[model samples]
Target: MATIHKLIALALAFTALVVVVSPATYKEGDPIEHKSLTLGEVLDGDRMAHSLYDIKFRTDVPSKKVLCNVKYTEKMLDVLRSAIEDLYYFEFVLDDIPIRGFIGHLEEGGFLPHNHKIYLWAHLHFNIEYNKDHIIYANVTTKDQLPISLDGATTPMELVFTYSVKWMNTDLSYEDRGTRLRDNSFFPKNLEIHWLSIINSLVLVFLLIGFVVIIMTRVLKSDFARYNIEDEEEADDLDSDDNGWKIIRTDVFRFPPNKNLFCAILGVGSQFLALATGILLMAMAGMFNVHRHGAINAAAVVLYAFTSSKLG
Candidate 1:
């Protein structure tokens, strides 16, 4: 009986390894909290506004919830009005997923007047995706809202916010989940050929090269004929008629103004060129990460900082 049990355990381990099936017990975590939101005034992180979450725990989850009504004064309404005009988006952070919602969507992202009836997002549906027993992703979608007129309203208006939570089971790993989120990924997956974009790019390149080659060949052919002129008088005539790129020969060959600045620019360009080449070579050789952009950004930062003295 012990030998039979050993055989069963060995069979299970072999099957797991062959099928690459990942199985684990679910560990319940503390209640979800801290649903913060933020607005980025500038692209800079320091120039931003944050509304930290004031979390509350409840037992009767009751998928759909009516947290409370928020009373907004005219001043608050004006702030939101400006946000809508600027087409700002609200971003919230869940455990691992980053949720982004537009403050409000307008046709062609048009601005609305205060006198016009405006609608605010009142309900949100939170969809949580889990694999095996671990929460992997969370997403929110705006569902329903009623239009409220803010024209000539003296009383404080109530902005009711409600939310619902739902869980979904997935059979994907962490990496697969992330790639799936990037639905329109730029990279070629599984060595698949992107024939459409590739053909378009190739045709465009050939057209551009054809124009440049034809034009340059004609210009250089005339230049060559002038240079090889046997008659001195005719040669002077051809040189005098130098109108296109030939006219700038002396200027292009001469030293540029601001020698220091020119040298600095050249050095910086060369440094960056070298840096880019190195990065591409390393990336192709599997030095950096495959999908995570943070890795690329971190590599670029370190490389730029170290090579700044030489490049800049």
Candidate 2:
């Protein structure tokens, strides 16, 4: 059985290595522009597999480059019109990283013939971050693009496509690159961490803990006084007086009717609380290295397995 287990584990490790994605390569300052331009709807959907349109790039230098000039034929104009009407966006791949681009806008509340003015986007911008000799991160944005309106020439117009590249030196480690990107582009404004909100939460947690300790301490003090009084007076007097709480004999300390269920619930709660504390301590001791690609979750799962095995 142990031999079989080892073989299975080896097979799983081999499978993982086989399916692992190779990191996209980028020379010191040079970024590779993929030939295929993936175009799709604003939301995630199927994109084009091949390069539908011919795009030429002149790599003059890493800093600036003339991307391409597209002469639109009747068919190309139809495609552009459909994409604009359907709110489709084209994506440019640099270093195997995709950046979304907004093509143009279609006039609403007008007849098809009246909305003949075609606004075409011409420029593309790329921001690449590198650490000394290695490219750490790259992002391409076509947002807030100023379009050149081809007003009169509606049939087949030639559009000159241009692009600009900017390289920035970054001090961030590789593991923190994903976090920086998410915090910059993806994180919602309203959900951002505010100092005021954090302060409020910390105060609230302390207040709750203090309240529980104070309340429990005061309640048990009276019970301790009652115990001393019972020793002097008859014990029957304490048994008859069931109005208030007592830590030893009252309802607060009594065993629940469904004792098994109560024990199970209490045990599970305690285990989870201990598990959380263990994870917190590990993090404080610098156990959490990578914050991306489920590294933290993987660590948590392994810790949970060991803790659970010991408990069992």
Task: Give each model a TM-score.
Answer: 0.54, 0.45
Best by lDDT: 1
Q: What lDDT is reached at residue 59 by model 1?
A: 16
Count of backbone collisions within predicted model 1: 0
Each candidate: RMSD to true structure? Answer: 14.6, 12.5
lDDT comparing candidate 1 with the true structure:
0.51
lDDT of 2 by residue, 253-277 (tens): 7787999887777776766777788
Local accuracy of candidate 1 as per-residue lDDT tens digits, 1-312: 011000000111222121111011001132212212222211112111122122222212335565445566667667555555555555444433445555554433436643344445556665667676555666667754543444455657665556666667788787576665555333335666588998999999999999999999998888778777899998777656546666688898899889899999898998898778878887778665433324555666667777887777
lDDT of each: 0.51, 0.49
lDDT of 1 at 58: 21
Span of ten consecutive residues with least summed lDDT in model 2: 1-10
